[model samples]
Target: MTVTVRDFRPADAEAWVRVRRAALPYMVTTPGQVLYDLARAHPGRRYRLLVAEEDGEVTGTAQVGLSHDSPVPGQGFCNVYTDPERLGRGAGSLLVARAEEYLAEAGARSVYTWVPDEPADRAFAVKRGYEPRRPAHFLHLDLANGTLPPLRDAPPEVELRSAADFADDPRPLFEADAEATADEPSDTPAELADYDDWLATTWHRPGFDRALTSVVLVDGEVAAFSAATTDGLTRYGTAMTGTRRAFRGRGLAKLAKNDSLHRARAAGYTDAYTGNDAGNDPMLAVNTWFGYTVCATEVRHVRTLV
Candidate 1:
């Protein structure tokens, strides 16, 4: 029962995705998406995908990289996931050990990871010299059975549109994402100043459903939007929901999320998922109003390499 850690290969895509989907059902993943990430990652990120093999079979995977987009330097991240059935076989540990070594060599001063809130997961992280920080919750909504808020009449100055409507020009959505992401609470603050990189990564992601993403327009300008990502099956996720600084407190974000959820339900997506930082009271309140309940939680853990 020896576990070996090695760099990820193209052939490992399916197993990598399977391990991720099983261990973290809340996050959307696809084989193509996995490979795309490894290939198109920003050069500054120094991204690497590691896999753990047990008796020649893939048992675990880890994504390790620097938070290159963060304004602060030397911020790194490593998230490891293993087949649940293969836990305690040292797969998780081996993958994490190799990831930390890589991060350290890449000039990462501190490494951040998201560990499941479960006792065993938290204990494992603590044993590895990581300290717990803020917690984030993953919420799920039963779109098929749960009743969504009725779509309210759009105000005279407000108009509803889909992300696809701007396919010809998605710069507005990128601008909104940049603004909103800067406000999110995280150990590494991202400076999304590279629109081309965003287009290659976020906008072109496999599960991004442009037609189902709802956007709010105030006087013909982008005000708020609820970006949607789906697995083309039952799972739907709110990729991002935010309102511009000048448009905050006007219920525009609520309007956009409500519209997006309704559209997701109508499009036959049954389960809706979204994550919120514990400190983001306003967005949490909005999701609660939409009947979403917390299904799982993960705590941010950090270890200083310097």
Candidate 2:
């Protein structure tokens, strides 16, 4: 069967999510989120969701777009995934070709992608002129079988709250996110300076589980947070866990994460997942202490578009 690549359509939502979940189980995705992503994307992003079909069945998917949130211009991304059982087909190459073409036409000077930390995957990226940059791990915790640590009580003057508590005004949470994100380790650093953009893209995202997203407040100020996402069923994922600079050594991050995880378990989520840059030893240690084990690794690869 020949593989063909084309732009994603509304009808492809289910298949797209299925293929993505099958290939990258650690990540959370839903049809509604996928459609929302495409519809709400910034024009500067030039985002395109592409699917590879084999004999009319969707076999692979790619998210191609420029990094609009990054201060750097001419930076693009094309993260592709294929159904594990359907590898070795031409779908991946076709997807890459089209994605790179689109990005180059969109004025991108370089493209970045995440390649699984396997010999074959690394070789494929290298063969395509992409060089390895940073490594990241996908950590998993079995909410049903694995034991989670007990949630600790917040210290005096500090309180644990749900993100939903800030529904009236999420500006504090947004401020915390911007500060934490600026300090995060990433190849394509982001600057969340625009609150309106954050509301539209991050806070209002369909996957964001505000009820389960734990926030730590000290003296009524955001100190730390663990943003959570769920599949609306059995899977839970920590989209981001960060402590404000002033609260870094206070163990507030772990506190927020534990609260989120404990509530997630009570809410009937069976699995939890998160990812951290390999260089981020602090977060890695925190995740390990929470019983999360590294399930997979992906290497960031970049290629200059000449």
Question: In TM-score terms, which candidate is top?
Answer: 2
Model 1, stretches more than 4 Å misplaced?
none
lDDT: worst 10-residue window of model 1: 25-34
- Candidate 1 TM-score, true structure as reference: 0.98
* Candidate 2 residue lDDT tens string, 83-171: 99899998889999999999999999999999999999999889989999999999999999999988666779999999999999999
lDDT of 1 at 141: 90
**What clash count goes with each model?**
0, 0
TM-score (C-alpha) between model 2 and the true structure? 0.99
- State every prediction's TM-score relative to the real structure: 0.98, 0.99
Candidate 2 ranges with C-alpha deviation above 4 Å: none
